[model samples]
Target: MIKSLLIANRGEIACRIIRTARAMGVRTVAVYADADAKALHVRMADDAVHIGQSPAAESYLVGERIIAAAKQTGAEAIHPGYGFLSENAAFAQAVIDAGLVWVGPKPASINAMGLKDAAKALMAEAGVPVTPGYMGEDQSDERLKAEADAIGYPVLIKAVAGGGGKGMRKVDAEGDFLSSLESCRREARASFGNDVVLIEKFILSPRHIEVQVFGDSQGNVVHLFERDCSLQRRHQKVIEEAPAPGMNEATREAICAAAVKAAQAVNYEGAGTIEFIADASEGLRADRTWFMEMNTRLQVEHPVTEEITGVDLVEWQLRVASGEPIPLRQEELSIDGHAMEVRLYAEDPASGFLPSTGRLDRLAFGDATRIETGVEEGGQVSPFYDPMIAKVVCHGEDREAAIDALIDSLADTEVWPVRTNAGFLVRALDAEDFRKADLDTSFIERHGDDLIPSGEADDAIWSVAAQIAAGDDQDELVGFRLNAPARHAVWLSHRGEGRLIDLAEAEAIAFEDDGDLLSAVDTTATAYADGDRVVVFSDGVGYAFDTAVRGSGQGSAADGAIFAPMPGKVIAVDVAEGDSVAEGQRLLVLEAMKMEHAMTAPFAGTVKSLTVAAGQQVEVESLLVEIEPDEG
Candidate 1:
């Protein structure tokens, strides 16, 4: 095995790799940007190197800096953990040329599977069933539109080099094909620097099932079964599980065999995943499943596979890179039990899932089976990086037990100030449809009303907040009797709504001594107080109320002033000063955390001032535009 390893990534994945490396008695080196100087991954590594500024373009994506850091730290090998140069063929070649072991597939293998259009052709030749799509080299507008029309009414236009749900669009009708294609191409060019695209017939009921395949330098390949990743929102995976709920033995065998064959065709080495899209309108079947793409590196949901199979994928990657044959035969690996994983992100579900960035005043996940995280209680969620804070995983003897364990773990999650999707996750896991395994890519979209929290504090939440605001002083009450109680009113506000809660002094003290008021009312609710402010957490959503005075919260969009939700660069400006605009008209686009958000006019009004321009970077709450509302 290699003596020392250099991790060319940051956040939870880096920390995860470091833990496994240390157990093998190998020294580890970590690379960090300006925003991650004090990150948990940096502190956990044996040695650290400062790469560059906060922006990923200035640091993590710079291959030369990572290579230099490996050399400086005397690391014999480099592990590109998941993101940032993980699948870059040229970077893989460069590492090999520099006489360092690259803990991934060879350059040729990565190149073979990098582009979707080319990979589908390769998989088809390998006898793997591929989706029916148009992968022709023609890039004309008329050609793509013609192909979409030929395929069917609903078609998918995917960027040949796209991943992570970016650079993709679903065209529902012929009239919207060209506009959707333009938007998809623009996003693809901005993200992948390639405007080439492929067309596919969109499946009405699709389920994302991917098989984990491993290959050795000795030309042996074996699959570790399949994972169900159909639970998604905005094309990004929210929940994943192993041993799909409705999969039968024959269907599983066929898909797993096809995955192994695809890997063999590339002469693949190390760890990789063959992702297939299944038409689940009638249930999983061999004939209905088809190859979508191949991720030529470790995946974000690999832990679910690891839980079901008693194998350490990272260790296998290390042993394979060090010239070892396949450790286990196809028959040796068997699914032990069912496992599930949920991504706990630092985003607000109430406000359209906008990324939340600030100090983690309070963060706790009590007694979870396994938690992969990179931020501590006081750490910051910078606007420069991905907003995912942690991954909560659980395992059980069966699927229902695993789901129940996960729900219990999520209910115990406590995060203050920074919003999270904990409540939303619980609701998704406990829904009747989810319990019945009625899953698809559109699960979140179809049940959004039942999933997303209302963000309004109920009576139980207000009662808890009032008790916390009362403090521990009993002498402050006018009529403090041992038997009877003195009534007192506490004023509070949430999201600009004010409420006056009346509770007896004795009742408040009695509940406080019992220490189960919130739990009795709502099992998922908890309360915390900071100075004069109290925040009640229910179903993983934190509803903060000001205890000092009513109506002290921030103003809303009714004033016609639009502020930047977070620090980001203005990528597009669609309106000029004094321009008349209608409500909901797109005014500008802000790019942050590798995603684009459009700012729109809140009301029908005239542009009073345009304070920002394209290419300018602004901080949070910085006014970007002000409009003068029209008279009624």
Candidate 2:
């Protein structure tokens, strides 16, 4: 095995690799940007090195800096954990040329699958079933529109070099094809530096199923079953499970076989995933499943596959990189039990899932089966990286048991000040369609109204907050003989709305603090209190309330002022000063955390002030534009 390894990544994935390397007695080196100086991954590694500034472009994406850091620390191998340089073939070759083992697939395999158009062509030549699409090298708009017409309506326009849901657009009719193509091309050029695209027939009911495959330097390959990632939002996966809920033995065998064939065609090494798009308008039929693309490194959801296969995939990556054969053959591997994983992100579902960033004043996940996180209680959720805080994973004897356990685990989640999608995930898991396994890529979009929380604190939650506010005083007043009124009022404010609750009328509430989380004794409600602020958690949603006495005053609206929702760079400014616009006209676009958000006019008006322009970085709540409403 390799003696010392350097992880060229950050967050939970880096920490995960450190765990396995340490258990195997291999020393680990971690590289961090300025923002991650006190990060959990840096603390966990045997040695740490500062690369550059906070932004990824200046730090993590600089391959030469990473290679130099590895040499400075005398690392024998470099493991690019998933995101930063994991799929960069040039970086992989550079590491190997520098005499350090690259714990990933060969650079040749990465180059072969780097672009979707060429990869699909290769898959077809290798006798693998690929989706019907246009992958030709004609970069003319006329050719793309003509191909879309030939493929039929509802075709998917995807960037040739895209992943993580960027640079992809779905057009439902001919009239929208040109505009959607333009938008897709612009985003593609901005994100991947490649605006070329391909067209494919969109499946009406698509289910994303991917098989985990491993290979060795000795030309041996094996698969570790499949995972169902049908639950998605904005083309990004929110939840994933192993051994797909409704997959039969025949479909399983066929999909797994094709995955092995695809891996062998590339002479793959280490861990890789073969993703397939299944048309589930019927069920999971082998003929309906087609190759989507290949992820040339470890995946974010690899933990669920590990749970069901009893395998440590990171350990396998290390051993294979050291010239060992794959640990198991295809026939020797089998699924053990059901497992599920949910990504806990620092985003607010009520605000259209905008990323939330701040110091994690109080963060706790109680008694979860397994948790993979990079931030602690006092760490910060910076705007410079992915907003995911942790990944919650659980295992059970069967699918039903797994779902039940996962629900319980999510209910115990407690976060405050920085909002999260925990409540949204809980509702998604407990939905009737999800529980019945009636899943698809449109699950969240179709059921969004029912899944998102109302952002209101109910009477039960307010009562719990009141109990905490009246702490110890209520206990002392028990059995008082003198002039104690039947009810005492407690003044509180929630979301800027004030209310007075009668302490005597409140239902008997109890609380217990277990050093990690504050829970209502004998109830499912959880709460946290710091000074005058209290946050009550129900169904994994935190509702913050102020305990100080205050008059009932409504909050003022922004009227015509548009503020930056989060810290981001202004990508486009469509309007100018004195420009007349309609109520919903596009004003500008902001890019943050690898996503674009368009700001629109709140009402019909003339632009009075335009303080921002393209390529300017703005902080949270900074004034960007102001509109003066049209005179009556």
Q: Pick the candidate with the highest lDDT.
A: 2
Q: How many residue pairs of model 1 clash at the backbone?
A: 1
What is the TM-score of each predicted model, taking all chains together? 0.87, 0.88
User: Where's the lowest-lDDT run of ten residues in candidate 2?
Assistant: 549-558
lDDT of 2 by residue, 1-632 (tens): 89999999999999999999999999999999999999999999999999999999999999999999999999999999989899999999999999999999999999999999999999999988999989999979999999999999899999999988999999999999999999999999999999999999999999999999999999999999999999999988899999899999999999999999999999999999999999999999999999999999999999999999899999999999999999888788889889999999998888788897767877888566689999999998888998899999989999888888888888888876678899899899999999999999999999968999887788888888877666656544332225653445566666545666666766466667655345776558887677877778888888776775322223222478787766678999999999999999999999876789899999999999999999998755457898889988
Candidate 1 local Cα displacement, residue 201, angstroms: 1.5
Clashing pairs for predicted structure model 1, backbone only = 423-539
Candidate 1 regions off by >4 Å? Answer: 477-486, 505-523, 549-632
Task: Show the lowest summed lDDT stretch of 10 residues, model 1.
Answer: 549-558
Candidate lDDT scores, in order, read 0.87, 0.89
**Model 2 global lDDT (CA atoms, 0 to 1):** 0.89
| lDDT for model 1 | 0.87
